[model samples]
Target: MNRDGAAPTMKGGQFNTDPIAAPNEAATAALSQAEFELFAELGRPRAVEAGQVLFRRGELGTTMFIVASGAIDLDFGDDLVTKRLGPREFFGELGLLIGDHARSADAIVAGAGLLIELRHEEFQRLVDRNPGLVCHFLRRAIMRVVLNEQGLIRRLRRRNQDLEAALDSLYATTHQLNQTEELIRTDELTGLYNRRGLTLRLQESRAIGMPASLGLVLVDCDRFKQVNDDHGHLAGDRVLQAVASILRSVAGPEDVACRLGGDEFCLLVASSNAGDVMRFAEFIVATAQNLMLMPQSPPAMCPVSVGACMVDPRADWNDWYARADEALYQAKRKGGNRVHWQDAALEPV
Candidate 1:
């Protein structure tokens, strides 16, 4: 019997000469009794022991084998299923048909038995003596080669599809993660950087030693609570959005406009000049005052106080915030709607 535990059968419904048979025997490369006996007479017999390797994959082969009384295993490797041939079954026909052909698999003996080894010369003699029978075996061998090629192509196609799907899934997951990170650091109402976003930006800039010199400007909507009380919170939100827009307009390309919280906004300017920071702060205040004079002014329009200061790289965010806030307090103390800025000199600890 073959590895499938089925009795080997002959072609054309003839009884297989082997004592054992193969179940569901469709078309095989096994030889009939007469063919085997004839080849046995022409070919040399090799006595093989279990675990003996007849030939390794990739070696140049010029011979074929017919299992006379034992089994042999063909290990194709690379996860391909191994095939076992029992008595009367033949393998490695390609080597005989195509001289110097590379062996595709390792042929190892599964048990101690005799194998009929046929070289190219012996195969030629058999073809001359019995052309019809040799032609049938050749056809079966060719069919097996075609079938194996088709099967390998199908498996490779499936693996390629699976790899593409995995790559697509990974791309989608990365896109979603990026969007989520943006949302976390963004202000929904003003579409500006939130507090966390501003802090992160500053940290990143420092890490890269960018923006050789920096400045911070803080702005506060004057009498914001009164604006919410006079109009509704909705109007107050619109007012804040308008202020954010003004800051955005005044900020440079490398600058960051952020709404820290509530009615407070800030700008991280990529400049060290106190005059530049003061000018930015003044521009914001003037813009807000101008907004109130517009025909379609914001509801319960109010002016905003501004503070400006150059940053000291050695200092932390808290120090920067405190210095800017103090200047803002000074502007507000002057009855709001104005700008105040500190000197570029570093403050003593």
Candidate 2:
């Protein structure tokens, strides 16, 4: 796993022990056998018992440790994250030579662990005494830091790719889920809101606590089945698209327009007054009629009948919708192409 908390591997049992492969060895040459012997004199090898914590997370790390013969376990925490290190593999140099930063993980003895530790001050003194070695050691230190950073970078890049792929997969899955949801909520033939979508929208509109009023519109295509029977399903689809376009253009940004199966459509308007809704509905009716005057799409002429209901300050949304539906039925019954308003006395408008 990386810093992003992604687990790359299940087990925490990776260890490297070749002395030649130790990070920052380019500087190690300066510390000849004699100088290294000096370090041995200054510091001593320490042994830690199994399961014992050698260093803890968040504590200032000063000394650097090199595994001599045994292995050490690094724990991230109760998350059970651990990394193992064997002979010659070292850690803590990043914090030791730079500004004091807390240790990122806790190091514990895997079984019996033997480690050589070099205190910061003693190590610095040796570097200071051997100025020529300073340059080489600095280069080595930089390489180690770079390697650690690169490892982390590589891990992060991999994780990002994985997350991106996962997100795309999730999007595809959600799209399929949405199609399934639409099947449940939408009319198959007209691509309009079935009864389910209208109910959901009504419920959602009511759920929001707003001070403003709400508006509803119910629309029916004038002589829809006649066009379908005369021009065929393709022409019927064109008519639906034309009316849908008109509705989309006329409705407010916050408003929702949905096909309510067959030739009927509905609109939900929030935070608006009855007058605005009426004007919008009028626009829809007029625009749809104008479109019908154009060259008939293939073979059918399409026009729409619109009916609207506005919210009453004191009436329930259900009652308002019922009145709107009544008005729509009335528009169809009285005339094929016209607009009607809900009786304010019957509900909220």
Candidate 3:
């Protein structure tokens, strides 16, 4: 289309001699007055109406069109910008230059006017008659094709960059969400699974079907409140940390160690026998006893009482907890530093 958006003018079946002013006139390969006259004499003149389709994309074409009057629009699909040709502007030249060339854009009439159609034979005749003019047109056409291709490449690169940026942002958000969830499930002070974390882990384990054998051991630091009262809470914290370290040292890879609350801890171990659970509980008591006997021991370093039970897969968490807690109460009543074991039926073992 011309810069003014006006269709080419015609008078008495002929185009005016004025120079064609196209959009981006410097880049457009418009035919000069002499060239248009030459093509008009050599080519066939066909009258076209508005809304008429000259050729569609992918159609085999052997003819080129010179717009003698009005305008023709070339529609290149796939988000590419369209181009319009006014008088003296030509399209479909590749069809004559390259035999059986597929049309790249759909050529549709924008306004009714005369079009000069040049078939392969007529184009060859014109080429032989004036090789210089044909070469000049070919050079301009090549440059226009290069410029259009470069523009398309630029647009594609920008789209790729935008897509990559969106993916990066999504990944960052997902990573931050995972970190936040981990923090929520962890004990801030003890570096162990908090109560909520333990519950989640148990739920996950249950989802996969409970193992045939499991052991639950509950440990409580005897006189922990007295330690916090006599010595500062800081020392009590250190004692708790030391106990936690012992639990970590003895826990198997498959076992879960957790701090239920202040001075109260739990261990979930994989074991089928009541003896195995009892041994684990006894080990914790012995380890705490050794910590208290260490030279220059921290103040109020008391022993721990332990209660353990072989778990029944059919039983709920409350039943398991109640049995273990009862055993714990019995151990506390007997004396602070000791181990107690209960069978799956809640009978003392």
Candidate 4:
């Protein structure tokens, strides 16, 4: 753990300094200047800038380094800064001493700094000539190995559990967000897309390239007020729900079926063929007439009037809606149960 050369003093009965080991001298005199220079025999000077890659994870390494100044960081290619080595600290000790060792992580320069790289061959020469130094380093390396195997695994396991919990929380939050969005865009009464949803779709449509043809249908329930007046408001709600179901059944997946508030509903569809819009509108009119209402009110109760428009290529949502609304009134004027088609151009009629 003291790879940073941060030991306050060196001690142990096996190793002792002679005259300099005087009673007055402190026991913690770590690597005296002269003694430290011994590593020069193995040193090859290196300098690095911040963020520079010194070595990569899982690479085979035959060298170790001593940080003379600045700092080096070990990473597993994540934002987590795994280990940091300060001045005089050493890393790659395992790979250098253990023949054919592969790096467990990446090394990067954390700041501008210098280092002394010692290859395995130089270490062998040093150990051969200076047999006494072997015991001390070997003891340290063995102790480090024991600590890593035992401590590192326990630490990493706890970290993994913490990560799993964090991921679960993230998933839950995302699902809640989706549910909230669904509620915001849907009409509470009929479960159809609301006016807010339609506005958003319109804005998105405007941003795209012009379609071959877009169709809009405006539907109105005939004498809806009479139902509320003759029967209770509950009966009126049931009538609206029935209308919504009929529109839902008639619409395709790509079509937008919306309750535009009150007794009015709208459908927007896209088709490659210009004639498809008129045909779709006709089908909707026929289907609306046949819709069965509950508790059986008079035939006048749920009749519908439909106005449809094949939107012009150059027109926007406002223009299309106006034309469709005009057609809807024309249908109501002629008779309650009918479909009126808006032309490419809205004449003064």
The model with the greatest lDDT is: 1
How do the predictions measure up, each by TM-score?
Answer: 0.78, 0.62, 0.71, 0.65
- The residue-by-residue lDDT of candidate 4 on 159-276, one tens digit each, is 8998999999999999999888888888988999999988887777668865667788899988889888888788899888878887798788778899999999998887655467
Query: For candidate 4, what is the total of clashing residue pairs?
Result: 1
lDDT of each: 0.80, 0.67, 0.80, 0.72
Runs of candidate 2 exceeding 4 Å displacement = 1-47, 61-70, 75-105, 113-197, 269-285, 288-300, 313-318, 344-349
Candidate 2 weakest lDDT stretch, 10 residues: 1-10
- Per-residue C-alpha lDDT of model 1 across residues 37-138, encoded as one tens digit per residue: 767988999999999999999999899888998889999888777888888788777888987889989999998999999997677798888787676566
Tell me how candidate 3 scores on lDDT. 0.80
- TM-score, cand. 3: 0.71
Q: Which stretches of candidate 4 lie over 4 Å from their true place?
A: 1-92, 99-119, 122-140, 149-163, 272-276, 292-301, 343-349
Query: Residue-wise lDDT of candidate 3 within 50-150, one digit each (tens)?
Result: 99999999999999889999999999888777888888888887787776889989999999999999897677788887777666556656656666678
Q: Write the per-residue lDDT of candidate 2 for residues 200-233, one digit (tens) a residue.
A: 8656656875447778888888877888888788
- Which candidate do you rate higher for TM-score, 1 or 2? 1
